[model samples]
Target: MFWLPLLIVAWVATGLSCTRLCLTAYRAARPGATPGQGHELTLYEAAFLSGGPTRVTDLTLVSMARARRLLLAHTGWATVVDPVGGDDMERSVLGAIGPGGQSPIAPVRRAAAGTDAMRALADRLVTAGLALPEGTWSGVAGAVRQVRAAAAAVIALGAVALLMPAQESRGEAHVALWFTLALALNAGCLAVARFEIHPYPRWASPAGQLLLSALPARGGSDLTAVAVRGTRALSDPELRAAFAHQDTAHRSH
Candidate 1:
């Protein structure tokens, strides 16, 4: 039957895509090692796990601005009032601002996030099982996207199968029923994945998420709040405006 070939293709695509998603989920969930007992994440580590390197950069900038070591003007310019960096992350941000001691906040954020310091931070988190290894979250997210594409392909193939003239006595309804089985399999796999493996982390792993959740909640300009919630936690309108302007400037580029 002409529809048979299309049905075979649909089934093959569904099986392969679903299998890949399952494998990716399994690998992402495998924790490397348990962190030491009573360990707590530093503000930098918390920022990285909560929102990645960009968040870390934002925290450093806000922290320094509050301490008067750096100035984040509402005009979106960052001026280094204190050249000395308190830590590696701080030093990275300082370097991004350059020897002139002034730079645009947007480019500084991007440059700081891409530095060797960020890589080292990621490596440390991965080693402690607090964050997924590089690309693991992306791998799972990619697998999920592939499964979605396969589901769409199955639907398209099923429609084509229904349109094709039957060379045998079997009706169009029978062909459709066969195709429906493949479609159902794809849908069921996606539903299961949504519950079991979805909400893929952009940074932190399961262990890291647990730690994040355990942290005492802070609000309104608290450094921890800014670290956990990004610039939104900033109580200062000027600080928020600076970061907001920085974000708009970055997106425009």
Candidate 2:
């Protein structure tokens, strides 16, 4: 009966993790107020829906750089050429770059993404039903991760149960068979969750995802490519190098 305690713990973990995942998924898929009625997403909006605030910041930087309004050096510094921002996002980026007109791209991206303008953009998308509220996608993703951890814990517990001393009547094989049932439960739950909710969205809701999918395929413009595929879509090698350098620097921190 010593293995019974471990079995209880395994089942408890499985139940809690799976329940959290299911709830998170259900909340994420719930309908928003005033669903969008063929509302067209602007490039900025599209970028946000497709990849969240960081993507919006990336698109803005790329567009400004391409238009010669901003200079993106291969060394990861951004220089303001035009001095005037065309929109709120651009203004936020400019503000992040500071009045001196030059700043590192990594800090600029992070700063801009947390600006009031970005929050307003998220609010607009949520109101329009094209995007989920902030953190919904993150919640689902977190829940999924918890479930994965639970699955691993179940496997470990099962192994421990099999390794423990057997009772007078029960054998190691018998204990393993019982623990296998718990393992099967964990496996089945994980499999179902993967099938139904794998590849969780980073920001967009189901509606936003649909809108993103419906966007025209990338073609004919560097801005369009950046809007869809992010900074890597920039055709300018220096710009690509600049962003890559920024990413490397940011990760190093």
Candidate 3:
């Protein structure tokens, strides 16, 4: 019975240590943010370029053609003067690209940006189920930095809590304290990587503009105009729906 408190302390300490270690390792493996991040054109970019917003039915063949041109331009490839006839762009001379797809071009390889403020640009593309085919890590360094910062903050807070004189008198408190710290650290790391850091600026602006422009135009006139002049292009049904929804919702509000 005398060992009960000691056992609890040990269990908590072990759990905390293991959890913190695992969390740290997992976060470390994650692709974080870096500096000088850029991206190729995508289907969503096509939609935005062709028109401001569009509905499901608006994505006709002409719209797609315009998107193709924009995509080629944005990617620094020879602009497609005319629309590609068939659906499959992957097998074309430009090389295959789709949602979460990669490019054969080395420079376009996915990499992280420098700041936490810009990480969301890539995050949006990633969440949209799109990426460069090669899966190169960009923006990861920045993301790592942000994650480290948050994790350190959490750890520091835990340290401070443990150092409090009032808390020291309690038995098994050290284990509980560490466990709390570990959890906080893990949460902070995740929060920083997923939310804080991103590839584009947080606000809608030039950086955001260029990144968004990379998406293939699948929507309407506003996006089509851009697509007609971009370097690369792609098309996706779901992304069109999302843009349409966002536009409609914005209009309603």
Candidate 4:
């Protein structure tokens, strides 16, 4: 009777906590997944793509770095760029990387001041490559759907706990105790829900970036070169036409 309800509450709490933590980790493992953008890094866990030497040669990473630098160069240092584009871009980019719109100064005290600043800066740079939403209604709708579903489930589970009477209610103040328990359970669920909707601020460490850098396996892995080459590749109409022609020719054959 009471034991079952108590057990259910405990079980639900445990499961919810685990779920929240998993969501947090999902956002954390990616060096650049931001909250506002709703896109997080998915692959590259453990060893970050196996079957490769100590060399770094992932075409995706190369393209990411290059694209980021190009955006940054056009935007200028974090402070001097255009008010609208720079601010919006940085906020969106950093938010996607789990920084949650936090200023560079927040993560500083966690480590040596110098190291923390460097790490924050590196994290910011890496974040430039993250693709998050541009704050559109569709983006909001998606986020709302997820948050609402999670929150509704939590609330419904908490309601079930209240509906079930505890055996211990046979004693004095039983009703009060039951209500208190219900409140606590409900609060716990809500808190977890809030955390899921709005995660704590954290960012990737420079070491993480360096580790990713080591994972690549090709030359021109540097962001600058990647940006230059990738941009040229995209913008050159002649090159695109040539490739399109070649592709057509190959298909015909």
Error of 3 at 217 (Å): 14
For candidate 4, write residues 16-44 as lDDT tens digits. Answer: 55455445434433344323433222222
Model 3 TM-score, 2 decimals: 0.28
Model 3 spans with C-alpha error above 4 angstroms:
1-133, 136-170, 198-253
Tens-digit lDDT track of model 2 for 131-169: 887777778888878878887887898888777888747
lDDT of 3 at 242: 34
Better of 1 and 2 by lDDT: 1
| True lDDT of residue 153, candidate 4 | 53
Selected candidate, larger TM-score, 2 vs 4: 2
Model 4 C-alpha RMSD to native? 18.7
Best by lDDT: 1
> RMSD of model 3, in Å?
14.2
TM-score of each: 0.94, 0.90, 0.28, 0.25
Writing each residue's lDDT as its tens digit, candidate 3 over 216-253 gives 34344444433443222235444344334434544565
Model 2, residue 170: displacement in angstroms?
5.2
